[model samples]
Target: MSTSPRGRLVVAAVLFPLILASCTIDPSTGPVAISSATSSGVSLPGATFPSGAPSPTTASSPTVDTSRTTGSSAPSSPTLPSTTAVPAPRIRTSPADGADGISPTAPVTVRAQAGTFLRVALTNPEGRPVTGAFSAGRTVWTSTEPLGYRRKYTLTAGAVRPGAPRTESTSSFTTLSPLQTIYPSFFPNPTMKTVGVGQPMVIIFDKAPVDRVAAEKALSVKTVPAVKGSWFWWDDRTVHYRPSTHWKPGTEVTVSANLYGVHLGGGSYGEADRSMSVTIGPSRIATIDDATKQMQVFVDGRKVKTFPVSMGMDKEVTVAGQKISFVTPSGTYVAQEKYEVKQMSSASYGLPVNSSLGYDSRIPLAMRFSDGGIFVHAAPWSVADQGVRNVSHGCINLGPAAGRWFYDNFGHGDVMTVKGTSTRLDPSDGFGDWNISWDKWLAGSALA
Candidate 1:
């Protein structure tokens, strides 16, 4: 409506101010601030102040747009921190190369992270067992036998994950320097003999041995009756054997042993088994009296012969212990060799008559027995001292032919008893094993 010049002029003035305010506003910049606490008025650069400084005043209620929804997911998102990192595996053994030795003493062990074990084996260049021994434990693997002395050997081992098949790893390394020359002493000496039952086979080694199982296996005792027997190592040097019970008087027994490469009880090895033959003789019993210095010889309990034998003299007193050892059988004996008078020099006998009743002295015998030195011997030089006295050391002094007759009849286990001596008898003496009381002899034998 056209109100007139004044009314239109008034409306133009008010509208003109509003138009100037809009012109000064940055249309592209939208608003100067959208905050609720503060506001400023905008005016054209050429416009003049309408009133004073256009003082700001707080509005009790203000109009604002609140119609749009602006909640949406952001394009770039936040990430979390990690706690673990992987590690590299390791190698522990060497030839550094995957090579092996001509002979390896042990398998190469490789330690790596993936806590699983691998296969390690010894092989010849041809991939054979290589004579190797291996050991296995809860968490470790090792070799059992020492590697072959001079052969080429290879080792193959591997590691795999917990549930997977074991992966193999191979390492090639030669064992240290070659083995040294070893001189073994456990074997038996070259000179030894195998014996029969009558012989009471005995052995004396140079050293004590600890490998008893081995030593026993090396020894073999066989007989038709299949007698039970054992080997007793009396001392470092001596070992004796006997039947579980008394040997059958006429039964032949064979004893053999091979200790040439045997390891005895200790680190020592036996030299070898020696062989000897014992002729079983008819059983006989002999009795003697210390007070009388007399010997009664019986065959199967019948008195067949008598002999005057001397007991040990004062200092050379006869051994008082029982002879439950190597028993020389009783039989007629011949003077295999003898001397009417010969020089003797051992400290045991008073006269210079060193006779081989069943023995051999470095010096030739003044008298002799059969194979072993238990003889009815002579001492022509002691002729005056013969029958009337029991003065000769433990031997039966007789006329030469009498001794030969004794020798011709006597063999191993031929009983011969000597009594009436002041000396002592040790288990080591050979006075006819029966010389000792039967009870005591039985006590000495395990089966008795």
Candidate 2:
């Protein structure tokens, strides 16, 4: 307590060193300590220290920073390689594989899926290629021609897509076999060029069709100056078409039989199609009256000439168990043929040449009109009986002059009407198409 000022200054310098050694500064904590105790056993305000513990010094180990510690980071997931899948090409065919009994007219086709076609082929049993064409994009193929009946066909096709493998397909099929086939033939031969007004359109078949309705539906008739007409079946193999009346002069007629590929029933099919055309000529008609024993010829509704004629004598003879009539049957007939000289014989009608009513001789200027051996010809031996008495077989007896004139004037399909006779003319005797009524003719058609 009794020290001088100089002595106090020396003591102060010595204490300053000890004070600096006792304190330490931590960067993480605040700058001041609170309620710390000094070496004099006194408590200092706002300074903190643990009881019976020494204060921190600058030499203490530096605080380790645990927030940023590093040894090895977490391993990342391995990435999978990127990839894309492609579709393969596919080929399809019609009349599928191993097909049988296919129609010849059936359609044949090939198609590609997810691809374009590379090649396509169809071949017959004979190894010949069938004709076909591919679509614009080369994805489809179709057949162009009809196939043969009872034939086997093969198809081979290939297709491919971009960055994909090529694909191929094959198929085989067989066509149906018909039991029989029929062909049609047209008459008044196509070469005739022109025909009479009363001429009918006739069709004859090599083999009869069981399905008559099918055959009738396949036929068609067209006329320029249209006329109403109907078809009549004369028998199983014959059919005829005629107008309600005689065809008009100058009329053009065309007939068609569209029968190919048509089914005719009972396993039968049509072999081919046919057609014909003909022009109608001027009208020429001949009328005979048995009461007057005269024949009048008319052209276009005007009488041209007349001739006295003697018809068959009214008699009958029995030979070979057949009844032969001498009377000429009465009905309409057409001029079928002509000859300068034709041999007449009774043997053609089942009468023996040795019989009492039998005679064989060469006649002049003969014109046949009936299938029963009836004709209009010259009989100089019976000239006295002309237009006076009937004395001869079933023929119209005319004088030599009249016979030559008639033969020179008449031709095929010229109409001839005969009246006043006991027997009736059969519809089957010749071109008897006109004998049937219109209603009856229409009834004969299968479609009716």
Candidate 3:
């Protein structure tokens, strides 16, 4: 509509103020309608916009400013590179980051969520790889065996999303150091081919272990025939195993000391693992009755022969006003060593051979059992007392005929059981393990 210059000026002034308030001009984005709240896709140059929203544009439609648009025909914002859909999973480790004083047996584990484990590498400070296993789903890895004490270990784990690069994470920890370490020294000495069926397996420790329960639990025994047996502690430093009855002849037995990594007690742990196997020989047993003054021999459960013998003195009153008796100890024993002719003297038992009550002689047919100087040997001097009275030192005195027979027929590892003596065999004396009752034996077990 044509209007005078003064009327046109008035209309331009009112409309220009309103238009200026609604639309704003910018150097980078050309123009935009300013609002109290931001437009859904509107943003400055190089500024990031939220997902599902477009970038800032001129007043026509929301579009990115690839170049300043002077008209309504602005092109669609250059399709933003497709946003990352899902991030790769992260790795997490046990003994998180840098830990210390870990147990040697505790597992070092790595796991992932919303992803799968690609690699799990655990190594010692020297970079030696530790052995481990992966879970069925491959989402976790754990150590298979025990770690070393006072050692530093490093762990690195990698995880990946379905189509993402592997992401790695690392951690480290140290195991606790033991205050001490122990090892077992058990018998049949690891060399004997055959042992008496009555012989018990004995384990002697270098020192008393701190945790007897753990130490005992670490030991095991397996017989080829699988006979039932149990372990008993004779003392803090020693343990023994035996069947309910004597082992069967020709039975093969194996003993394992799986002490390594076992916590022994206090701060002590086991040092190493050990194993031994032995065989049981023929069954041969000898029974002696101090009251009857006789020795009965048995072979393979059959009674063989009997011989008249003399045992230790009932009592002897000495000049020092001391009543001393050379009573033989009564208990089960094994013939450990044999001698065709062994020199016998009071000096061997810490007595003066020259003394009036002592004698020195070369005794024939000696089978020694007790660690003390006790033996079943020929003592012809006491022949008159044989089968009648107790008249020798602690030796089981036999006639020349009987002694020679035993020396020729009795083999090493044969059993000998003494009865009716007032002096009981000490559990630690010779092979007197059978003297203890089964219940008493079991009571000594740490597990009990």
Candidate 4:
């Protein structure tokens, strides 16, 4: 409807109250005025935007338009920086990881790099911790004693940088089994403070080893001032190490078996390393001449005494109630045993006692050389043939005074060499390595 300007003013004033009832006030701008010409139920161009919005030409306008987008809008918060810087820890080990046939005695060591160590632990399969200690500087750690055989061990190490997370590493390994192990029992017993100059170093095995060469290579001998020697195998179970000559009196000898990781074949391995030091006593040797029927005793290479002695009988003798022979086998021998009064019996030697060929007698001042009942003992009955002829059964028959002197002086390891006997002595007849030639003795060595 059209109205004159003057009449419209009067109508406009009356319609103002009614028009104001349908319009809303804008807080940013004062009020929104509505006119009948513009009231078409449609929004004005900039009316949809909130007040104080930037215009199209304003410098504060957003770079991208988001009005046509479907989702609600606010920019996402920027990603923040991490709180701490962490360093990765690294580990190195001895006997290296996954190594096989490791020695039980070898040390297990662990070292960590790039950070201070926090903790380290070594455990067996049962989770029982192995005892260990860190180095003075705290960079490396090692187990205190030998590890077990056929065992699985686990090692865990931890380290950390300042204000950073702890870093850790782990390794696992298995040790050699008992089936791969060999142990050597040494000679001279190591308990004897002093041994004879002629005492050979003996080593006996609990079980026979298949790879004798490998086993021999693991053994070594050292003297204080170094002496030449050779090792000889008596059998699969026994071995001897002897110097070219007797040990120099007062010299120290050290024998070592470094077989920790050595393979002894037949699924046997050396279990652990072993070593021993021994001292040699004075040199004493007795040389018996069967042809002359005399015995010469030497102390440190100086002939000290000569005694007339009648050795083993020319033939087996049977007298009284026993059958006995005085024939002593010819060889180098050690004093196997000694007794003041040893009862002699023919039955012990598989010979029957008969009135004419055998006799049982209790002998005095007896020093033995073999397990077969051969000895240097007093034989008063053969005193007439001491230095003239061999008339008694095999044995070094000495006069009463000479027998007492020899018996008192000679002990377990004294040396005696017998010459001119038809009966050859086996090397094992006694503890007599001197019976074997040096070349032949060396040939017995696996490492030769």
Candidate 5:
């Protein structure tokens, strides 16, 4: 159609915008599209124009997109990763699998690795918790005594390893009729320490304790002015309390043995509380060394007298140790002084006389070694062999002068020591004092 110049120009500008939109836009029928409004009207780019229009042209479609489009295309929705949670741990094995009808008297136990603070509870058929007669320790928990006769017990325990999620474990135990009544081991039993200057306080128990380590801890002792001391467990049933050194003269000493209700081994228990007082007497310590063949007496840490003495032969040397043990079985015998110049016969002595183990002495001396054949008699023949040379069977020989000195000075409880030799002290041999250090002695104890 024919038109004025100004109107024609306006139409040309509008046409230019519509054609440009068609080139850059996408088709709405396919994956994407763009729409624009102009004076001519709304126009859809990247799509077919109206048929028979002033200009009709077909354009190629955009490459189809398989992946979903984002902004400026279709809508986009947020996505979240899949998720799940972990569970807790549980016990794997228990007492056992199905067995048979079990006895009710049997004891039940629960155990686990350390640091698992487990709370255990037992309940009856009616769901009531059995609370009394229960005990527990660092590694174990058990009934203080036997459980009720022929009773059904349900136990539940809950525990958690450090930093682990809390978990629970449970089991059931049926006890048969009571066959034994095991008593509970009790603590904090009463204690008594002896306090006397001359007393060696001792604790005597009816039952030997099984755990000496624990029992010793229960005992306590202290002097008015504290002294160094230790516990000597004579046996499981008895313990002696003594100072490292003897008590100082005139010092007051007290000792106690705290043992009660502790289950000593062999189905026994400790006796009543024990306390003793001791009064230290004058210092009396004697040392008899085979070396130099002299006996030195000491009082209050000062030497007093020295005496010459005879000793056992190499075949029967005195034991080697600090103290001299007089393990002689006490008995009496008449002193026999005679001259047996001729080779003595075994038949000369009364009781199964064996001259082999005894010296055929002519000068009589009464000696005491064993009850059967014991005597401390004169050995004038052994005078030259005293000291330097090891001679005279097991009996100690003495010179006439020194013998009389010892005979006159000696009294009951007067210190006597015999040391130096190759013989080892026999455990049952009582002839030794200070034979071993207290620690070494304690090491030999079964209690240790």
Candidate 6:
């Protein structure tokens, strides 16, 4: 329409307000037209312009996400690593499979890792099962008894976890076969188990042990009420144990030589274990004085009887290139053995019967006190010299009645202390362990 300038200004002024209310400009998308009903619509830069737009009749199509436009793709979820199943626990056995030369004393054991034991067995060569016990929770098993020497043994064990199959394992081992085996013999044989307080625990090996310490280590002494004692190696084959003082009367003692499977040096091994138990009877001690030529007997520290005695004559004689002293060595001694009628012969000590000082006779009511053929016996021939003079070879001569009384009253382990002699008793002579001082006795112990 061609209108004058004044008319155009008037029209522009009237439409300016309406246009401003209908159209809005966006900085990024240029301009947007407003629908009268919905009041929202998007307009592209080059689209046809409209002063007003109608609202859609139905609910507007679900709002399209304008964040992503048409030529772009959606991102995929991150890939996850695959998972694996866990295995069940395994069973273990000791000694390892195919082991040989195992000690018979060593314990056989079975264990399970993070599982409970299902079954365990150890079988000997004879197809017999060895005794064993299971630990709490059934997780471990151990053999209860020692195995046999030079024998093969088999072990089998099984364990399982919840909802899993049982896992089993097997092992085989062989015990050592010793080249030489030595057996130990204990003193105070089983027949005469009761002994005096001075009696010591003695063990004599059939074969001399090269490693005395090893042999000593295997020996043990247990006394009721607990007595302090130590073992002394008397010789290669003999070891003796004594208390610091005389064993208390009525004490019970148990000795163990647990030497099985012990390597005792050289090619020797212990044959088997041995044990002995003995009870100490009433304390009976006899003291003899060479100067007084008298013997006093005591029971439990109380003097009970006194008798005349004739000790060795304190004479030395040369026989077979050896000087044989008739004087009995003085020291502490223990009654080792008793005999109703013991045969005495100087020839036993290298003196022949033809020699002037040699004599062979059967003596009655004899008790041996030393390994060197010394004894206290009934001597009818020397009865007159019993109290007044010292006569007879290395023996204490007692009247028949006195000897009988001693034989009837005294037994093994009874103490016999002798005084006034030039020579001292050797510790290895009979049960002469009391001759050693307490300090020296402890020094003899292997463990000490």
**Can you give the lDDT of residue 91 in candidate 2?**
59
- Residue lDDT tens for model 1, 1-448: 5599999999999999666544332223321111111011111222211111100101111212111111211121123222232221222332233332222323323333343333334444444443222223212333333333333334443333432223334444333222231122211222322211234445555554555455556666676656676655545555556654445655655556555433344334344345443434565545556555456767755788775544333332232342221222333332224453444443333222343332223322244433333445554544455445555434455544444555455543444444444443444444223233445543543233
Over the stretch 1-448, how does candidate 5's per-residue lDDT look in tens digits? 8899999999999999676554433222223111110001011111111111110001111111111111122122223222231122232212221212222222333333332324555455555444322234322233222233334455554434432344444445443222222222211122322211212345655445666665676577777667776666555566555565556666766555543333333433333335555445556554556777765766667887765656656652222332322222211111112121223322333312332453343444343322223233355666787656656544556676655554444322233445665554442232122344667655643445
Choose 2 or 6, whichever is better by lDDT. Answer: 6
Best by lDDT, which number? 6
Residue-by-residue lDDT tens digits, candidate 3, 49-108: 222211110011111111111222122233332334344465556655546666666555
Tens-place lDDT digits, model 6, residues 341-414: 99888889988987788788888999999998889898888989998888878788899999999999998999
Candidate 2 structure lDDT = 0.71
User: Which candidate, 3 or 5, has the higher lDDT?
Assistant: 3
Give residue 21's error in model 2 in angstroms. Answer: 72
- True-structure lDDT of candidate 4: 0.67
Q: 1-448, model 4: which lDDT tens digit per residue?
A: 7778999899889998776665543223322111011000111211111111111000011111001111111222233322333334345566454555555556566655554455666666666666666766566666655566666666655555443334545556666665645778887776766677778888887888899988888889998778999999988978899987788888888888876656788877776678888888789899998888789999988999999988776675554565545567788887777999998876676566664555688899999877666688887888998998876556788999999999988876678888897777777876878888888887888976
Residue 177 displacement in candidate 3 (angstroms)? 0.7
Better of 1 and 6 by lDDT: 6
lDDT of 3 at 110: 63
For each candidate, the alpha-carbon lDDT, in order, equals 0.39, 0.71, 0.70, 0.67, 0.40, 0.73
Off by over 4 Å in 3: 1-81, 116-118, 135-138, 305-308, 315-324, 337-345, 359-365, 378-391, 398-413
> Which prediction has more favorable TM-score, 1 or 5?
1
Task: List TM-score per model, in order.
Answer: 0.42, 0.70, 0.71, 0.72, 0.39, 0.78
Error of 3 at 44 (Å): 51
lDDT of 5: 0.40
Which 10 consecutive positions of candidate 5 have the poorest summed lDDT?
34-43
lDDT of 2 by residue, 1-448 (tens): 5999999999999999777766544323322111110001101122211122111100111111111111111222233322342444555566655566555555566666677766666777765666666777877666655566667777766566664444656567666667887889988777877777778899898999999998998899999999889889989998999988988889999998877656788987777668899998878887888898888988878999888888889999887688889998888887778889999899998988888988888989998988888898988888888877778798988999888888887777778888997888887787877787888989988888
Candidate 1: worst 10 consecutive residues by lDDT?
A: 51-60
Span of 10 residues, lowest total lDDT, candidate 2: 33-42
Provide the lDDT at 273 for model 4. 76
